[model samples]
Target: MSYLVFEQVTKVYGAVEVVAPFDLDVPEGELVAFLGPSGCGKTTLMRMVGGLEPPSSGQILLRGERLKKPDRRRGMVFQSYSAFPWLTVAQNVAYGMRYRRDLSAAEKEEQVQHFLALVGLTDFASEWPNRISGGMRQRVAIARTLAAGSEILLMDEPFGALDAQRREFLQLELRRIQQEEGKTVIFVTHDVEEAAFLADRVIVFTRRPARILAEVDVTARLGASRTLELREGTDFFGLRNELLHYVRSTASEEEGTA
Candidate 1:
């Protein structure tokens, strides 16, 4: 069985069906992105996988084990700016390990340092949240999630709040962290370029009561290197345009029907 599996998963709220029955299976260490326009149920799908919300029907399994409820094994990053204003970068990361009474103080510190360095925020470890930029705060959020020992990371438009340059930089940073940690990631984004740049495979979805519309395999060869050259490469643009074309066509069809 695949590491993470969503089989005919659906979510309905009262009279409204937000996400249709959709199926996906991700191998143990793959990074996948969900791309679509707003209101397309991307966030809902991520929530379902994170176990924050239960599926109306169907199943979600990780490592062949069924996910019954939210647990520490799955981490999440939201679009909302989620850093505690009072906490320093290191403190923020340490917050995740608070509930783990089993770990000694020294062990928790080691985990915090490891994840901070993974995201290139070791220098900012003592800096307050307000002292750094939005991008940096988001990095802290990511590091905190990682420090919690979650093997699966769920990101919902995590970079949507940053400027273009920062967003792009963080995307590369995320890719690097994913590589180093070998974490299973399901990232949700509306940006086609973001999906193309970061994902091993891009899954597209339809409008509300969303279903998987298409899937594109992004085969960029960049490893842990975070050079701007990856974004400018022919493969990047090619894959990005393909996803954009899918979104545009879907939008056009919706307009015609309206």
Candidate 2:
């Protein structure tokens, strides 16, 4: 059985359907990227998995259990700065563990230190969120989610706010963390290259009332862990261009209708 299941899940606001009846299966420890145009319902579908938005119909299942309300088990990292301005870097990461009943205070502190070191923020543990750069703040957000014991990460363009260089760096950072933490990630992004770089599999979506356009397997051809060097390789382009073809075809289809 698949680790995560989107069994005929859908989203609608009033009479407008943002997502059509959709179905997908994600395996454990795999990073799946939803790539599509703006307002294409990719994020909407992801939100349902996180339990942030209810599916108008169908269900989101994790390990065969239905997900209903927002839970710390499936944490989210948003595009905007999500760290608490008043909290220090360590505090932000530790904050998520406050509600973790299984962990003692000492265990929680250990987790905070572990994640802070994972994201290379151990030195800045005492620094405030407002004092750090945008990229650093995002690192804090990721650390917080993992420290809270969220095995499934729902990332909604978490690095989208950063510049190209910073974005690339964080992509690698996230990839490393995912590899080490053994987390299942459902990433939503508009950037084709970013999706290709980060995802083991990429699911392309059409315009509003989004439908699955294509699913391209990247790690089958590309290496398990991607780097800047791979970006210029033909194998990488093949993975990226394949996703681009599906993305562009959707744009063409929209234009023809209009």
The residue-level lDDT of candidate 1 at 104 comes to: 98
**Candidate 1 at 194: error in angstroms?**
0.4
Q: For each candidate, what is the lDDT?
A: 0.87, 0.92
TM-score of each: 0.94, 0.97
User: Candidate 2: what lDDT?
Assistant: 0.92
Which runs in model 2 stand beyond 4 Å of their true positions? 256-258
lDDT by residue for model 1 (117-235), tens: 88889999999999899899889999998988889999999999899999988998898888888998999999998888888888998888888889987754444344579788886
What RMSD does each model have against the real structure?
2.0, 1.4
Clashing pairs in 1: none
Query: Cα deviation of 70 in candidate 1 (Å)?
Result: 0.9
